[model samples]
Target: MNCKLLSVLCVAASVHAASAFTIDYDIPAGNVIVDSIEGDVAKVRQDLRDTKNGWFYWAFRVKGAAGKTVKFVFTDKYGGGPVGVRGPVVSKDGGKTFAYPLDGKSKADGFTYTFGPDEDETLFYECHPYVLANWEAFVARHAADIAAGKMKVETLCKSRKGADVPRVRYGCLSGTPKYRFLVTCRHHCSESMASWVVEGIADAFMADDDLGKWLRENVELMCVPMMDFDGVQAGDQGKNRAPHDHNRDYTEFLYPETKALTEWVMGYAGGRLDAFLDVHCPWVRGQYNEFVYTPLKDPKVYPATEGFFSATIEKLQEGGLRYKASDDLGFGVSWNKGVTYEQGWSSSSWVVHNVKGLKTCRSFEIPFANANGAVVTPEKCRLFGHGVANALRVLMENSQPKL
Candidate 1:
């Protein structure tokens, strides 16, 4: 055999092996920005273009490296590394089913994984991403409810990129002015867990028992599953985007989604909104970020807010995820208290002051994982949501003012 021919074959084999692994980020909320790939290490970072402080929201697919071990190094400046004990979320079968790659590990900088050779593709995300598909599934699961008028899907408005912003409306249409309520989530697309918590609360509202029945008969539960639909679909890090995000788009009401909802609420709600809850997930795990609680605000609203918080905490009886009243962000003592948006006030705060007759308006910071010393699994996340919903039910049943 010619030595020259053998050398050529060796070079060709090496080329094929090197080109085998492919990384893709074309799906919804799929945002893995690969800086470079060298050997078994792929140096990556979160795709953040228009934000002051970049957030960790990445999703990408790895092919050909199924049987090989690889290290993914994230260069994003994270105040806290990947979520709680679970270092990062990975899906062997697309984004339909997700599991913590490093369960309760809390490892950071990057993670090393050796995929099953048989697996054709695997997805990796910063956290368990809940996107449009999950929303559709949750909606479909309650098909009977929609048909029976137990739930109605409303298109709030069209996003900048021509996507429909969906708001789920549940409870009584003839809701007494006192029982009207509104909830919003996913203003920051990276904050995916907030929407899951919302789902759990929605599940509770649609239950069949006395609490569910009463909620259906007497109260109105409206949910904006995702506010920045375009941002979410594009997988943009919307935290502190260039001009303003959905959360800060109030006051002047810049974005279309924010503007449309404002007009709708002004005309439709007419200041009779009993409660308004805006859902968000804070920084990575540890201390304040790992618990579910509302930010402390003016003492004037504390009585009602504290009352509702206490009731919700009480009803959260059995869930693995829990929220304690003591965990509430204090007015001046907490970090959230000092932060302010230069453009305008936040949705919840704006609603509390501008919307008349509004009893309670607050923002909930739900942990991405490792909340209350428990790993935030899909099942536990849903159960925790049920706890939120139960608490909402308790708040409405006994505290409404006479219509």
Candidate 2:
């Protein structure tokens, strides 16, 4: 072979090897559209799917990029871009665990990552993702309790896609309890951080501590961890979906999940729900999305809601994520007005209007990445959940009649 031909072939091989990296969204809860890849830079944007307007939720996996630094640049043409305050929540271990790479590698539109020598693959998400695997791990952790019947895991309903939606009944599972609390998460499928909070709440209620014992005796907690199971699993942005998302379907009971959840709650409560807490994650970044807050619902229930917010703030101060009473969005303040629900009523609103003897019905929004300058980690979110559990105990205690 001629020397010139050999040199040309060698150069072509190097170029091909350098550009062999692949990006895909085939995993569970994955969403992304790869635009193009040039050298080490990949142009990408979130896959909006059935989302009405623009929503910021995306996840994808990078493979064959080992030992190479790749820069993921997201486009903002399709609504708000997918980048958050602290950049991407990344999992080096193939989605087993994720943490925000706040190590100065992020820009306003995207982030850069350098894969390790042996790192065959890595997962990146808008926020830490919580899918069925995460939930199954939690269930496994409390296997003994579940086996003993202290915690009952039952199917909430079959999703439209034929998946079994799980509902966990913790605390006071036997007979009737003095109080019944309904806690739900993931009304918006992409709000994965809230699932960590739900796990934290369940942990607190099932612990052997004084609070857990008291809860097991006096309160019956029903938790529907994933409300939009199909959307969550399929990685759909469940907020403002076409006709309406699961949250907005509360009034008309459009989605099968919403219908089943409402009917189940109504029948299970038997006329009264002491507390209805729906956990969610606010917008990707900015203002109210950067902190933990509850949207005040209904004027007649404001006083009680105010007291509960105060209690939660007090408990949060003791430990966990930082929350202040001033952060609570009032009923008419900002986007808390009725026009926001023009499509339909939200879960909290529906419960407030329909459920009888409800002490407090509110939605708690946990930020996706940042909360009051603190990085929102799974463990920290769980700690926040503990604070919420303590606050709920206070609310229940306040509701009981004095002897």
Candidate 3:
């Protein structure tokens, strides 16, 4: 079928299968693909479109089970960062409205499931649900809130070629003794979903809830929204590229963004910074694939910072994000030891090894393609980010005595 005709059918089919099921892999067609759409539930799939901001959209559907519970699971192949997997939601009024529910779940196995959607209903999510235009508009609408000193924006540092690394710092108050946390996103460039999680964390901070207030009082955050600007804007993989990879450049300080951040950490930190975090998508395949990374097993000879890293992970776990000392490959093991993988580098490892006074440092990997067997989506990402922020807070509070 032609692209237009196929697109129409894909949408129709997605609407037909909203009870329980999932779509697998990147459709790569910029349109939806129905794997199975019949009966009380159907499964659909779609490829992440190569857009300006580089995002993927998953499609959904539901029918005949009005008010009945339903769930879905989604998976992707070319997951980059948290934004790699889109989300799913339902619409009862015939595909005209949507709402997010805490009813879905994700696994470290590359599967995503939303358990309940009444029959004869429609669903929507980040997967084929929204695009760059929507996000840009959202950012635009919140520009004033960000500019009015309520949220501060600054240049973290300049890239190797002198490009400026812009960062957004959000909190309710100023001049408070916050914990001083740093979160960098899109380090690999193509991981666009990292942007969404960054946005979600910022929004949560701005909401000024108790946790947010506590965050404002105990934490000062800095976020480099898009680290690999050139690559992201250019739509290149940005991982394992020639000359230097953004993550690898941390050691040599070659790339402008990496160099800028390295410099910023040295200058902005008053030797009392609490935590440092790097966010990205997992690209590895198999069981230990869809999980977060905390430096557990430090390699034999590489810059062994496992002592500090272990303490930090402990604090992070106290905050709600589950973690373990698995044989997960970390920055030191991959880059410092010359263990070359597709994407091998870590800001967490870089900071723990090089930067002084950064007590709790770690990188979190949210699966985009198949995190624990479920597709990563905006909603899942939001939850994951909250867990991240919470863990950062805990790490901060826990590290106070040492600092």
Candidate 4:
């Protein structure tokens, strides 16, 4: 064969192989933008969508590349691009579970994957994903309790996109409870780790253990599992969304979910909210972002906050993800300052300033991938939730009026 013909055939085969590989964001909580594919490298970026600035929340799946290796490159320039500390969490069995790619497969901006010979599909995300279906599975686990009226799941409200936002009520639902607490998570849609922690708290309330029984008999707990339901389901980077994200919408109440939650809590609390815990995940990776900590939003509530932190830290020592009181970010420290709220009031800020007789209101930041030196996982997050529940019991007991 002529040398020219041989060279032409080689180039044609390479083009066909590159064209055969495909990338998409069609799964639940999926987000990605594939720019182009050349040989074994695919240029892509997070679909920023309505996000006002660069944020690192993205998930996507690749197919038709079995037995081949591909290097995903984030072409857009964001603060740190879309890659995470532990690298892209990968799932081969259809998103049911995920794990960070083995060492040497990840870099500062992306990761490489060599799909198994028989593996037809794979999912990758900035972190382990907890979508609406995960929450539904959790609710299903308590089916008997839900049927018995021990737990209730109702729509918080219809999101702007017309999806039913879920609100869970459990513990002391019969008569007026001595203590009422509100726990919220997923104000930032991509902050899925918080949902796991919230599940742990709910599980604690439903369990037959001492803390659970105490909570069931004396406390009425309200939890909004996915505050930004639309963003969560749509795979949006809910942080710093245009106009403002759900957390920042507390003041203006632009979002339906936030408005509904605020009104419901106001009416339900009736001037006596024991505590308001807003669960969240910090940045992709960094010092404070890698630890479990709470922001001290209000200095006036420092004593109450200190007491709660002390109790939680002590309980944490029993078992669960490690969290230290020293990790708490005080007001005006780091990003917990006035500038952070220039966009609007966060849930913690609103609850502290508006909810009368509020004992203590604070936002808990659970790292997306790591807590201290321990790697964050669904089980660990739930265990942390249990610790939080135990601490709450102590906080409530200590707040009782003098005999």
Q: After superposition, how far is residue 147 of candidate 2 from its true place, in Å?
A: 2.0
Q: Rank the candidates by lDDT, best first.
A: 2, 4, 1, 3
Q: Per-residue lDDT tens digits of candidate 1, residues 190-271?
A: 8888887788778877788876787787778877888888877777778888787789878777788777777767877775
Candidates' RMSD to native = 3.1, 3.1, 9.4, 3.2
Candidate 2 residue-wise lDDT, 140-207, digit = tens: 99999987766989998989998999998998999899888899999999999899888888888789
TM-score of 3: 0.58
Stretches of candidate 1 off by over 4 Å are 1-19, 80-85, 104-106, 174-178, 301-303, 314-318, 400-403
Distance from true location, Cα of 306 in model 3, Å: 8.4
Which runs in model 3 stand beyond 4 Å of their true positions?
1-138, 156-165, 270-272, 295-346, 400-403
For model 4 the local lDDT of residue 365 reads 88
In angstroms, the error of model 1 at 88 is: 1.4
lDDT against true structure, model 2: 0.83
Residue 200 of model 4 has an lDDT of 86
Q: Model 4 lDDT vs. the true structure? A: 0.83
Candidate with more favorable, higher TM-score: 3 or 4 = 4
| lDDT of all predictions | 0.75, 0.83, 0.53, 0.83
Error of 2 at 220 (Å): 0.5
Instruction: Report the error of model 4 at residue 369, Å.
Output: 0.9
Per-candidate clash tally: 3, 0, 57, 0
